[model samples]
Target: MRGQTQTASAGGRWRGDGAAAWCWWWVAVVLLLGHLPSCARAGLLESNPGLAYNFYKNSCPSVDSIVRSVTWAQVAANPALPARLLRLHFHDCFVKGCDASILLDTAQSEKTAAPNLSVGGYEVIDAIKAQLERACPGVVSCADIVALAARDAVSYQFKASLWQVETGRRDGTVSLASNTGALPSPFAGFAGLLQSFSDRGLNLTDLVALSGAHTIGVASCSSVTPRLYQGNASSVDPLLDSAYARTLMSSCPNPSPASATVALDGGTPFRFDSGYYTRVQQRQGTLASDAALAQNAAAAQMVADLTNPIKFYAAFSMSMKKMGRVDVLTGANGQIRKQCRQVNTS
Candidate 1:
């Protein structure tokens, strides 16, 4: 899918499939509200008044650059950092609205949850927080660092700034492993995925777009083995492309250890692009949730539409911004943690 050219006619055909209405809705919202100079988007700013485009402009002038520098160095050192950080951010936001609750290290913290056991990049967040602490003391929140680091990590991978992340989020004091259930599972079906997103105020479009992040990451064999070998060892899920199933079976043998990993997008695992959509279209999605996209008519259309790189990038960026705003805590609500790994003692 690397050299494939996105034709205008192809885009037009997708738009004709009742997707144009919601796509136009997003365009109007993004243009009219999202791109404002002050970033005073209604839902985000109106709901969380303390959040702003430059919330730390006076308190921490170098917040964005500091995060970018650390993220750049880490991503350069480890190409896998981007995916880990991005997944970390998603897990953080989904459970508790980008409040950095997932960062807490406690007996029953979100980080200790079963689903989050594999969530890496805590050291990356700690690294960024340490730099911010030196630069601004307690001026910046761990929540904001998580958001900025995720954005910067993706930017580093894309070789450009992907989107603007509104900051000023405060770290929550709570981090319950039980709350991690809010996260969408790799095994969820289409309805379950939609329900999970909808429960977070996200729509179908956001679900489809956010899932595109799989284009760059890997999934543990435990996550995909169930999709590859269901019912009996000899049987494979019929939805999977046979060749892709064979490849997955070879890489992730039956009764494979959870430690084994496979690329989410086999074609271009390291690239941040729309190749995942093509993989999903071909029934080569690495996870059951990913393959679920093709099970629904509307979602399948979205998967088809997002095959266009331009559309995919734009939608992904906007969906990220929207996701970043989920139930955020700002103003004097949550405290700014000096370290990302623990809540404030006082």
Candidate 2:
């Protein structure tokens, strides 16, 4: 039987040795395609770049929420802290793409309250660093982490589907306390905001677009009362509807700094949309920064442009990209923090 089998295999159909050789050759090809060029594929999925992005995508929301919550607490802890964070958000986004440099208190002013003010999200970033270190240490930059955090907070609060921004920005090591004037004041008229954003190399379109941020957050009566009471005229031009304004005044009151500001859209404050523009058209914009946009020739055009959802959506994304590019503090210049409210507490 063995002789017959050997004869058949050698002479015709069953060439076991030949079949084995073919199998090994195909296996080699498969292995090469799957595993070759480790360096070239290093940044691909399962590689460092992929992993870093995944880390940001997965980790950003919790980190952002934690950081934001801490900031709120800090604000609660001290009246100055919330104002600083709000101002920081305004300054950072307006200047260098919201890099949080406006929140830092450096050597410039030890005595000046405004300059020395810092609502440190760096501490939150530091905590994130330690945790990420436990999982994949030294792979993520604090800039990227915080940028993702900010974006996540916006997306989450607005109830938009996850809006992921590009990461990989390095944390800034130094702080600039003197640049606080860069942000627009809640009291500033349309022209003031336009000029401030323009100085930062941003356009009136950006000023209008970013003002939509007021949709999701609450404001103090001290900030909005002027508009509710008599109207800034230059800012709240045409004036808000008397009935609506009166209703708003009832809720906000006069003189109380702690009274809450009304939402711009009145409904769905958390959703990012063109409703903000529509509200401005209706004189329903709540903040001076928001209502003021409609008074400018350039910003008015932007507000009109945003009345079209398609255009507003497109312009909003572009504006966000531009806003994110403002004065980013990066590279050996920033510190990775263990907490969001303090500088490197860990």
Candidate 3:
């Protein structure tokens, strides 16, 4: 099995011996996570999340249920809301910590950035914030709302949620479009993805796992076209499945100005399942970033483990918990805003 190639059609899946390597480490991952509390394992305790899991228990008892209920209803209505909210969280965390900076509406806020133009669900975050204000005004932070709403969006729809967000994050007073360059690009390769994750103090495990969030989101046609036609079959990255490339080209033959979108996962685009990893393993990944997971030894090995729906679901939960902790604001650092789109009157 060492150095052997196995095509998905052959039922072996994942080229080389990655599958064999994946089998051994899969158990260790599960066992390691099972024994470690989420805070320690996700590194929330070390890099971020100075607050406790019960931070809002006494101050705002209904915060959890209210956010989940509102997010679930919105997702049920649109089905695409989860992915949008998830992207919002990623964009927020990548810039200025997870301080709700992405939610600001200033003339030069992160939302106005070129990379963040497609990110939506401002209304969802606002609605959740409004509900929280009525229930416990001036208590809950807008930053925490983004985190909770992201968790609820994916968990409620797919039942694949794994971690609870620790609260006490504050709203950042600054939001700049320039900060977005650190965020991962849809066209990034394996090295680019690694650096992007590493910039946020995340490791390869977090990169592979959190990337599964693409399982439920949509990518614009512009992002997809470059992957399909930038090069010929030989010149293009061999990781992409040929038939799948042809299929993608058919959907996005020409770049139109009207604005179009397609699911990042392509297979089970609306569900938060292990399908994304499998698609990546089979070279059917829709984005350059999605398909790049197989290019690295470490990431590909994890991809092999995550091919199983159960394993992928568990691993994804762990990674997401860690991703939410990237560069957070705790202690007396930031402020809670009355509205998510603006900082409180200081």
Candidate 4:
């Protein structure tokens, strides 16, 4: 409540205790006005004629079931596949707009980028694509497969569909490692994070909500080392909780190997829930970008609001829908690769 302002009723109008209160009051008003519709919100696919819920109804009627079945099998065996797929979908979208460019295996492709080197689930995607090809060859797009696989992966974890993934997205021919610079860095500050989101047409709400995916993932120690071992006098990020810093130090000593890893949400690393916001609130967020949420007043308030499981789920679902639509290739644009790892030679 340090930055929060007090409000009072006076005659017919509400008054703030001070300038900080006025600032917070306006922020609340803006956020209230900007509130997005819930996960059940409809019409996105319908509005875009190129994409549709029943895109493969005539061509590949079993598209949904096939993706779901494969995703469940992989996630069940790996338990970590859900987070990996979600991150894979995100990295794909941010670079070339959810076009499955991240799936390319070229020498200078996005997958070879420094930040993308840790991205996994390519095999899971290939597995899903293989099944789809046999079931309905050349009908389903790799972009749509990536989108659907991500949805099914998370749905498998929650035991229910998280959101509707509209299909008909075509794969892109471009996959430059240089383009991966568009990705938001785990080491970014609040402003940098916001800019990255804005570049992709996402907002502050989307930034906080989508970040909840961190609730179920792990971070490499190399990603956490700067926050734990490099700082002011104490040589620790002051924003990080003291005890939590020591706990991380135990797992990630100075000059920690790139192979070392830690749970992003130490409280519940495998659960897709609101615990991520709670960790950020406690100053125990596992990355610099995660901790940066608490540094901005508006983003901080959004983070606080998202700590509620209900709010987090709804916002995350809506944001996923918006993200799935980013600069997609439809109609006769890009080709659906016969193999996810390479463009169609024909």
Candidate 5:
């Protein structure tokens, strides 16, 4: 994939297709609720409060729980680190809408590669884990800690109540550097992203839902400026907003990879919704991968469907559950490491 293009050939280790249960259930719910108002369809958990609690209990932890587990004063004592962690929610939310793996050095698998612990977030997770170890001992899983930290990070930044996720996930002992390749590149187009998600057994709807993470976080100028400067005929695609495009490119001239890019949701970058879809329709999408989503037939329709906030919310929730299930190193495959950044020296 290059400038103004996308590809899906970078395949990961293929996982089995057992997610069909979740996929089918997701489809049935959407089809049945398709006729209702978006908000009506969205009150899924509100209708069944226990289901919401169950989802959290089965999936991951919440922000408030993790804060209670660790000392923020201790975290802040390390000057360079706190600010780095403040960016954690931003990084994860920007890509996959607050998935914990955003802080996972997915690249930690290779024997020769030094652990590329993601900035300070992973370190923060470890610090919190230590505090939890003293109080709860082995009770809290590192995975849960990271998951809750990420949720708390998002809730804090957005000043919104985050959905509670289930905890009790164990820490991953092995960190694979090659796994970093699995993270979608901003330069990638439609094909690359689809293949990546598909290799993980994610389908088209899952792809669109996962991409909703873009509703939060800032994009760099290098990612979006090309759509404005490159005169690629694809730029004229009606999905893009001309005024928004112009405004984005104005201060972004001679775009450095460091220059700021606008948020997909012109309004709220924190709360999740279909704003990303709207941005794409206006030609304001920030990445070739993002724009390519609108270019494809199946993906584009999902984007269009998302214009209905209720449909988008339900799908977004389901898709998130699906994304959370991808390629997890569970059972005997990988051990839960005490430290995410390093393999056990013993």
Candidate 6:
């Protein structure tokens, strides 16, 4: 009986020891997991993997649909809107990442810059924000909204071509006109354009691809006059189609501080097609920057390659995705302002 009791006690002790050992093993696992990279965790508690696709999947299910709805309405009302909104996003990202810094209303802001002066569509963004705030206040960041609006507007323009956007971006508090001096200018040469894109984490391919945005926008005479009056001696920047030059000079006989508006794509200005690539290849590119692509040996190949609708569309989508990532602040690192035009009072 004594031996049996002792045996039973030993069995119980062994069982307890085994259970404790298992508990300790789990604790070790928890501790190790706690130290993994921020993205490895699965919660909104932190912004690991920084921005993600459909980040508002659970928090705000209607976010994307809402953006598309608002964008489509604006575009429907004004077919010119997609280009304007797309330009707004590009200008925003170039200045200080896609932080909605461009959306901020302030004296002496980036909006004061010459390139940004013509950028419209502020009311559209405001309208979208107002609706989002109504649906899910503080759940979506203005930065993410701007990024999505750009994607949605482009997808709306090019229904056959689309790409996913990674969210989680936080709004920035700073917007300055002075910081934009480094941005690629209409007057930039290939070297300057290459550097400008590189500074913002883009490449030669990206430069040509994103320039496709010009396919649907208008270029002022001021942007084109130089290519004629002050243009390359090699017959209108050597890349411009001769007949197009005559047509441009006819409209822009004299340089105005702001020249007459002409479509970047000579004939099909409103269409978001590979027509811009075709123009560049024919030396009919409107801006010095667009024509410069043909001037660069390597970029010329990309220019030629993108002339194919399939290639240009794919490359353009990829480049836009890459551009969205410039100097972004993700996760809890930045604030989500109630108003995109102003930082939170806190």
Given candidate 5, what's the lDDT at residue 193? 81
lDDT by residue (134-206, candidate 6, tens digit) is 9999878888888788777766543322556789889989888887786788988999999999998788888
Q: Positional deviation of 62 in candidate 6, in angstroms?
A: 0.8
Q: Which candidate achieves the best TM-score against the true structure?
A: 1
Task: For each candidate in the order shown, give its overall lDDT on alpha carbons.
Answer: 0.83, 0.51, 0.78, 0.82, 0.51, 0.76
lDDT of 4 by residue, 1-346 (tens): 1112222232212223334334433453344335544322544334453677789999999999999999988776676787889999999999989899999998899999999988899998899899999999999998898899888887764556766788889999999999989999999999999999999988898899888889977888888988876755258888999999998888888877877788899897766768899999999998999999999999999999999776677678778888888889999999989999999999
Candidate 2: tens digits of C-alpha lDDT, residues 1-346: 0001122233332243445434433443344344335524643222222112344455443444444454333333332222223333454555444444443445562213352232334444455556655554444555455555455444322223123344545444444545556657877887787788888776776778767655444455566777755653333324676656766676676655443545455544434456778888777777767777777778787788777655554454445555555565444555554433335544
TM-score for candidate 2: 0.62
Q: In candidate 4, which residue pairs get closer than 3 Å at backbone N, Cα or C atoms, i.e. clash?
A: 93-98
Q: Please give, for residues 240-313, the per-residue lDDT of candidate 3 as tens digits.
A: 79888877766666653436666688777766667898899889999889888898888899999988766765
lDDT accuracy of residue 159 in candidate 5 = 30
lDDT over C-alpha atoms for residue 101 of model 1? 94
lDDT per residue as tens, model 5, 1-346: 1111111111211112225323533554565355346635556333321112333332323334545435344332332232344344333322322334444444434222322232345666777766655544434445445555644453332233233444334444443445445555666778888887776666788888767766655555665666666664235324456776666666466544453545555554433446778877666676667787888998888888886656665665565444444444333443345455444355
Rate residue 195 of model 5 by lDDT: 83
Off by over 4 Å in 2: 1-90, 95-97, 102-130, 157-164, 176-178, 230-238, 257-259, 331-346
Candidate with better lDDT, 4 vs 6 = 4
The number of clashing residue pairs in each candidate reads 1, 21, 0, 1, 32, 3
Which segments of model 6 are wrong by more than 4 Å? Answer: 1-49, 158-161, 231-238, 257-259
Candidate 5 stretches with Cα past 4 Å from truth are 1-64, 67-120, 155-168, 231-240, 257-261
Q: Report per-prediction Cα RMSD to one decimal.
A: 7.6, 20.1, 8.5, 11.7, 12.2, 20.7
Arranged by TM-score with the best first, the candidates are 1, 4, 3, 6, 5, 2
Write the number of the candidate with greater lDDT, choosing between 2 and 3.
3
What pairs collide in candidate 1? 93-98
